[model samples]
Target: MVLPGVYAPQEDTALLAGALSDESLPPGAAVLDVGTGSGALALAAAARGALVTAVDMSWRAVWGARLNAARSGLRVRVRHGNLFTPVHGETFDLVLANPPYVPAPLGGRRPRGAARAWDAGHDGRMVLDRICREAPALLRPGGVLLLVHSALSDPGLTVGCLREAGLKAAVIRRRRIAFGPVVRGRERWLRQRGLLAPADNEEELVVVRAELPV
Candidate 1:
């Protein structure tokens, strides 16, 4: 389906796919999809019979997800708002997010178009941090939070953040992807922030699954 304004899904979507456990998802589950860029994960969950509420800060993204759902003949509620604003007081069995995770430059300038779609804040964890902070309240007891982001952003820190928020967190999957030279500046910024090391071996996508205590 041609989702309006969403040119493509993120490469990390593949990592998210591995993190999702179809069996762990309750039948007819209610799902909250945060940062529904292209609505890929949200659509997948809905297709599996979960009732989905997909939220995106971008109006284009919201309309795109709704278009995609219509073309797929699926029922998904698309909301335009940052994080969980549109779904206040609503809880779900699953909260999935593939947030903007690229660290911005020192001057705070960002790239245009699709590249802007993925640029997180300085440490590459701005949106991720917010999601981890907000997810606990949005999930029901025993519900799962699936997050896909870069290993360059300190996977340990991400896991720790989730745990501190009272969830059981673990790295469910990791996948390496070739880094293009275009992102070297970003790599350097991450290194300087101590989020990534100069000697880091490779670029990788990390999928973390955190579950609320039952």
Candidate 2:
């Protein structure tokens, strides 16, 4: 069950799960799910016979993921830490991330409570940029990283960052979905930033796949 203050599974979660299914993993492959709110993606990977580890900065999210893994009878090592800190020095065959990508208004205090799940700083790259910089180190040779985020966050820049890190990266999938409560709440700010057109009612989510060279 999803504990209070944990991010619940939604369109982005389902989309990431679908991408995970398309991957061909060996038996007992190692998988890492970053920001594993409610353990949805982690559990999905575990169900596919992967040895999954999930990390979140929120204590509530860590517990929620652990509880969901237990209820699902899935073996997932859930840890509490910001981003990749808990998994330092560990490499995986696959890494999955559905990080906070909403563009929050500038000059506000760091997000708290449920808002922490999506209130990314202005431009939405606060966490995404860190993932690009650090994720490659967590992948073994030929390992894959699958990341999902809104087009508003600039998927092109994500691809560029991964490629600059010596990985082959590209957008593997795209889905147009209506703005969620979070994005809708920031509609005016987003439009002012040219991230959203006034006539647009939907945002596109893109799945980026980056692969490390052998």
Candidate 3:
């Protein structure tokens, strides 16, 4: 069950899960799920025979994930920490992330409370950039990272950053979803910034896959 402040499973979650399902996981592959709010992706990986570890900055999210894992009878090591900190000095065969990518107004104070789940600062790359910078070091040779975010966050930049970091990255999945409450709420700001057209009622979500070389 999702805790009151935890991010619930939505299209982005399903998109990442679909990518995980398509991957050919080796026997007992080690998988890391960053920002694992409700532990859905961690549980999914565990159900597929993976040794999964999930981390979240929010204690509520960590507890909720553990609860969900227990209820599902899945063995996922859920920890409370930001991004990759909880899994430091370790590597995984696969890493999954569905970080906050919604662009909040410029110069706004950093998100607090539940807003932390989605109100990314400025260009919405606050969390995404950190993940790109740190994820490669946590991947075993040939390990893959699956990340999902809105096109508004600039997927091309993500690919470029990963490439510069020595990983082959590209957008492997795309889905156009109707504007959610967050986007709708920021309609004027987004349009002023040209992130959305006045008539645009939908946003395209993209899943980027980056792979480490052997």
Candidate 4:
């Protein structure tokens, strides 16, 4: 069960989960899950025999994830901190992230609670951009990073960022989904920003995978 202020597993979460399942994870692989809400992805990785670390900025998420892991009898390292900060200097075999990518007017103030889980500034790249820039450093040779975000945030930009960082990056999956409350509420603002069309109510979620050279 998701605790208050914790992001529940939704379509994008399921998409990432499915992709994680399809991956050929080496036994006891070192796995990192950034912005791991509710510990779903991290637990899934643990269930596959991977050594998992899940990070989030919310204390609630940290506690919730730890509780969930303990209840499931899975070992997971859950830390509360901004994305990647708590795990600085660590390299992993695979990194997974499903960060906030909803476009909204954030007013230059850091959001709180549920809004903090989804709002990503006017262009929705606030967090996604940072993830793309920093995640590669946390990967070992031949390690892979899987990131899922709204297509409206421009998934290609992410692939480009990873590629620029010397990794092989590409969009591995895309799914069209109806706008969630966060997106729907900002429809007018998004349209004004030219990110959404007058008749558009759906947004595409894209999963970009980047692999470091072995």
Q: What TM-score fits each model?
A: 0.87, 0.97, 0.98, 0.97
For residues 64-143, what per-residue lDDT tens digits would candidate 2 score against the true structure?
99988989888999999999998899999999999999888867678877887887888888899999999999999999
User: How many clashes (backbone N, Cα, C below 3 Å) per candidate?
Assistant: 0, 0, 0, 0
Q: What residue pairs clash in candidate 3, if any at all?
A: none
lDDT string for model 3 (1-214, tens) is 9989899999999999999999999769999999899999999999989999999999999999999998998899988887898889999999999999999985968899999999889999999999999999999999999999999999999999999999999999999999899999998999999999778889999999999999
For residues 110-178, write the lDDT of model 4, one tens digit per residue: 777888888888788999889878888899999999999998898888999999999999999889998
Model 1 residue runs over 4 Å out of place are: 1-7, 21-23, 106-116, 180-201
RMSD of candidates 1 onward, in order? 2.6, 1.0, 0.9, 1.0
Q: Of the pair 3 and 4, which is ahead by lDDT?
A: 3
Error of 3 at 191 (Å): 0.4
Please identify which of the two predictions, 2 or 3, would achieve the higher TM-score against the true structure.
3
State, as a TM-score between 0 and 1, how close model 3 is to the true structure: 0.98
Clashing pairs in 1: none
Q: By TM-score, who's the top model here? A: 3
Question: What is candidate 3's CA lDDT for residue 138?
Answer: 95
lDDT of 1 by residue, 129-209 (tens): 888788889889998988888886678888999999999998888888777453575666667777666777568889888
lDDT per model, in order? 0.80, 0.92, 0.94, 0.90
Show where candidate 3 strays beyond 4 Å.
Answer: 106-108
| True-structure lDDT of candidate 1 | 0.80
